[model samples]
Target chain A: MANSASGESIIRRFITIISAFDDKHTSMSVAELGRRTGLPVTTTYRLVDELLLERLLERDPKGNIQLGTRMWELASRGSKTLGLREAALPFMEDVQSVVQHSTTLGVLDSDEVLYIERLGSTSTIVDITKIAGRLPVHATSSGMVLLAHSPSAYQDMILSRPLTKYTETTLTDPAALRRHLAEIRQRGFAAMPGVIVPESSGIAVPVYGSDSTVVAALSVVVPRDEENTAARVPVLMTAARGISRALGWRGKLKGTLRQSH
Target chain B: MANSASGESIIRRFITIISAFDDKHTSMSVAELGRRTGLPVTTTYRLVDELLLERLLERDPKGNIQLGTRMWELASRGSKTLGLREAALPFMEDVQSVVQHSTTLGVLDSDEVLYIERLGSTSTIVDITKIAGRLPVHATSSGMVLLAHSPSAYQDMILSRPLTKYTETTLTDPAALRRHLAEIRQRGFAAMPGVIVPESSGIAVPVYGSDSTVVAALSVVVPRDEENTAARVPVLMTAARGISRALGWRGKLKGTLRQSH
Candidate 1:
């Protein structure tokens, strides 16, 4: 239980240190890490030393500290996300091959859509999704699919919050978003045209788990001009079903299939 | 700072708690976790509570704790492995497609081969490699390819170890392995027939980084009887080069190309 003078627990400090790194900042010196985390230099050095000793963090040839292979291994070895990602990968590849667009698998987390896997395309689509990147749940097709499938209370919690208007088509109004969510549920997919990026459109479908609950969103990002919803939706739906089956989903359950009063 | 009376550091205890959960044991109860980690019940509960509060551990509906999405997100967001894996994925897909077998990307970690990414096949080849799985360096084709390009001192250190004879073909003698490694270095690939599993063969090629040093091994596992090295090696080599280029490797440097005395 290492607590700083600021009354922050060691775990919080550890998270702060780790969170200072991202795709753009993969490695840095201890001084820079301290500056980024706003932790005292001594504390940063101490925590980093312990992490390095455990091989959770490694120093490069230049002595810049970075996350270690052991860190990724420890995080991945028992992660449920790994199971979902593995289940979705082959199917996502198939969709990518057929659609010739970026295929992504995302799950709703912490009120946002966190993309877990993304297969890029050589096409000139303006998709901004990256692995481990998060986007607002109200703006992305994957987010809409996940939001549509979420429990009503959770949906209300998100809808009641002030939403960012990323694009003209983004559903920011609670009543409008609620209606759109219902429509997405009824249609079995969400196809948003330039909801976040003006040049691209994302089409997504729900991937179910063994309990018949939506566990992820299988999506494709294509050019807005080519908004081929008719063609793309079927491919995503098929691939999502394949992934769901791989995740041990035995179709839909009869009890859940019954209409709510 | 929260070290138990046993004198183990808090970080070490955290690692012990995390290491207790793997692919086979993705989730467990607090009592079960205590048993698995061999930590005191109170310590386990305290750590688990802190981890849960940080969203580093999440409880399922049944109250079994599993690795959290936040943990995976944090580990992945700034990891150098992500860049390497992403660079290798498209090429690995190509190798997996053409070879119709399991294609893997592995790196040298802790004197063993740690597989980072694996594209599985529908083929009947017995490939024990899994993402985040580790295998003996002397017994895997990926390991051999990586070892061949490693510094001479590392090669000496590994060859000095008591190597396990996984199969009749696995080299246990240091001299024999040294010769084989030289041949692999000269040939630009490693093809091991039934070195680990009796029914399969693995062929691997090295992937380079921006610094022109060997960073990873790209491999495919095929049926032993169908070990078509001639055709498969070219495919693997081609994909490895593509991945290397994607990782910013500008071919081999002139100084490195000079023969080492």
Candidate 2:
């Protein structure tokens, strides 16, 4: 209803302002924010003022603006992700304890994998996943597991797009990717070695929700040379099952039963 | 810039809409949302439409609207809370393992204790702390530790307010609380027995940031009957130091050093 002269809604401009900040640029001066968001200086100031009034944005002692704790609280208090994260954390810890590597819980969002919860390790693995960070759905084991369980039409939609070959082993050909997705569904997990990063391998299994539908992927990142799938997959599978049960998943429907080897 | 007929800005209305949903009411019908937010039907619908366009809100299969994953991602991606949470989690896990009870990391926000990261245990200690949930500053050990470390002006402002006595042990007298704050500052920890929930006790230690400023509180909840502060405080203090170190905190300032008992 509140469209600017550019025909963009206020919400769009708000999103733009918030999106200007990332992990690298957690705080910035108003002038820098205006430049980064590409909004008119006056518009940026006005929106920032309103946001500050509501404590949706705050200024540090150095007068640089950053996202407010209120924003995080409001977003988290009612978020479905919170419930999923709470349900998965304990089991993810168990997996992390055993794997002694980075363990992450990710969901398919916006055609990418959004890591919601990640327990990092002291290991020297070259894992790049960060909480709230995104990765291509075709280049990681978690993404592959999520994509394999998604509806076929959605898979087709993703496969139709040009995929980036991040590493030598990354599958970019749609036919090959489709075959791989089918195999992942059949095997109930995905183990991709050096697909995104040359030094790390990701092993992931699907986590089901109350409806027995795949809701997330619980995964571990280990050294590429140590792709011990037999030892790792069972740990992930067991933890994923625990998470699924915590989320009220009553087990798979009879006809859709899948086995993990 | 976009103020409604009642003179509330679009951002305020947006906050109202989002705040209507919470852990207990994660999703709701549009009409119910309008009623809950107390915004006009038309305004609610329009804002909901815009928010849906940005994927800041999503509808469940039952046509009920809830906070979107994008909202959580946006709030988390650049949030200071995320970094603090990440730094605290590994140590929080260790504390949880030993305490075998709920461990929480909270920051003082809007004059209350807002728990950012909590590692829940299987113990039946009656912990009321939830991630993103808030409790009054006077009754929570996390809140007291935070308040104790705060600037004198801020502490005076809080002390001037009419404090709620949640339980018989909750200190509502400004003079008593001020004295208690001094004790907490001197002792380097705050342990309140059944101050909020009658059955649970909270032992909290201040977690410092790089500047040696207390940025958050690391605490554990235990049964009131077993108020083992001697054993619990050291574990919390150890974990808090680890978290502080992870946050780049070196140690206390030379002249302002305090001892933990």
Candidate 3:
């Protein structure tokens, strides 16, 4: 297993090093990286040297190490994320243009809603979603749509835990949440006003894969006070169907029994 | 340095394993992976075990291993590519909508053009470009714009090599290419007709970064016989300026005195 003195595998340490970086902390000194990763100085330096030699990590103009283009290429060249994003981008553009707000594509990953692609006016909205960013599965419309389509057992497990309430309107009770999930599935989409942010509301519909399983949530974020927010649901549903068809989904949707043709 | 028995560091081996997968070859058996990476079977098995432990690689339902979501998340969460794509996507969509062709954003990486974002009709044109794909610097319009902005020393070094002639229009002669670069710099754009492929042509303009340096090329691909291709240059240039402004570019471009506002 190649365990070090602390009985941790080299792979574990590698994850620790890479996970220390994020959108906010894209680059840092080696000493700071060691502190964030909680590794010994010697081990940190040794591993970082090896990573740099392979160009998985690169030195910035300021001499601080950051993620390398090579690493992104290696990870993305064959990723399913790329294929999904490619299938969804054109349709997302249509939604964004018509909605005139933020359009995002998210998927359920490890019990959290991970945003894979987003498009919209960057500075004109109170939207906080970012590509590659994560949010709790109970606090966003995208998350609710995904959860509503997941297996009942899995949904129960997720709801069994305490959910964080980001706003006064966020539903934290397990029974109330279950009823809401049922409503979402029945309506063929989820619309939550001020669930996560009081100034923005999210509306999301499920995107399907070739196997007729829910693969992603196609959503848009608009001003909470926009009284006609419900009118935007057809635009989102149409775009979601387009994306689903692009992914080779041929069967009718589970609840709506709707076909793209 | 943690060098393995073959005198290569573990990091190098890690890269070999990851690089073995690409857009075409996403998953395979361990033995197939060993063959693709040119590594010993034992080393491949051991290293793959460690990688699976860290969730950097995963086994699909059919028992084939492929790159993991965690690997993609780690690489993308803090990538400079993400930032550039975010700044360029909205404007790229506008260009794509107007041109009704394939619009792409690419950056010069390792002396080649690497496309980071692409949009528009995917099936109507003979475009060979894909996100995460690379093309020769001398055979692409985007490459020409990047080369025109690069330091003369770097440009000279690239032109000194034997360039591949992908099509009859590809410029392989160093002196001819140098003259073309000068023209691209003077005109603030590069248009290559059937340079790499016979059926399509590319037109590109340079996008700037915060420090007012050329950081990317925004290009559109159109049918080679379309004489109106020149008419699209203004749209590309306008979108490029918007992207440059979004990146915080304020100073005048090196060759052109035009500003976005």
Best by DockQ: 2
Residue B144 CA error for candidate 2 (Å)? Answer: 0.7
Q: In order, what DockQ does each candidate have?
A: 0.84, 0.90, 0.74
TM-score of predicted structure 2: 0.97
- For residues A1-261, write the lDDT of model 3, one tens digit per residue: 655878877777877888888999999999999999889998899999888877788998799999888888899998888889999988998898889889999998778998999998668789999888999999999999999999999898899998999999999999999999998888888899999999999999999998888999999999999998889888988998899999999957454454221
Which lDDT tens digits does candidate 2 get at residues B107-201?
99988999999987545679988999999999999999999989999888899988988888999999999899998888888989999989988
What do the candidate models score in CA lDDT, each in turn? 0.89, 0.90, 0.89
Q: List residue ranges in candidate 1 displaced over 4 A.
A: A253-261, B253-261
**Rank list by TM-score:** 2, 1, 3
> After superposing candidate 2, which stretches have Cα over 4 Å from the reference?
A253-258, B1-3, B253-258
Better of 1 and 2 by TM-score: 2
Instruction: For residues A131-192, write the lDDT of model 2, one tens digit per residue.
Output: 99999999999999999989999999999999999999999999999999999988888989
TM-score of chain B of each: 0.94, 0.95, 0.96
What's the TM-score of each model vs. the native?
Answer: 0.96, 0.97, 0.94
lDDT of 1 by residue, B69-183 (tens): 9999999999999999999999999988898879999999989999999998545579999899999999999999999999999998998989999888888999999999988
How close to the true structure is residue A144 of candidate 1, measured as C-alpha lDDT?
Answer: 94
Q: Clashes in model 3: which pairs?
A: none
Clashing pairs in 2: none
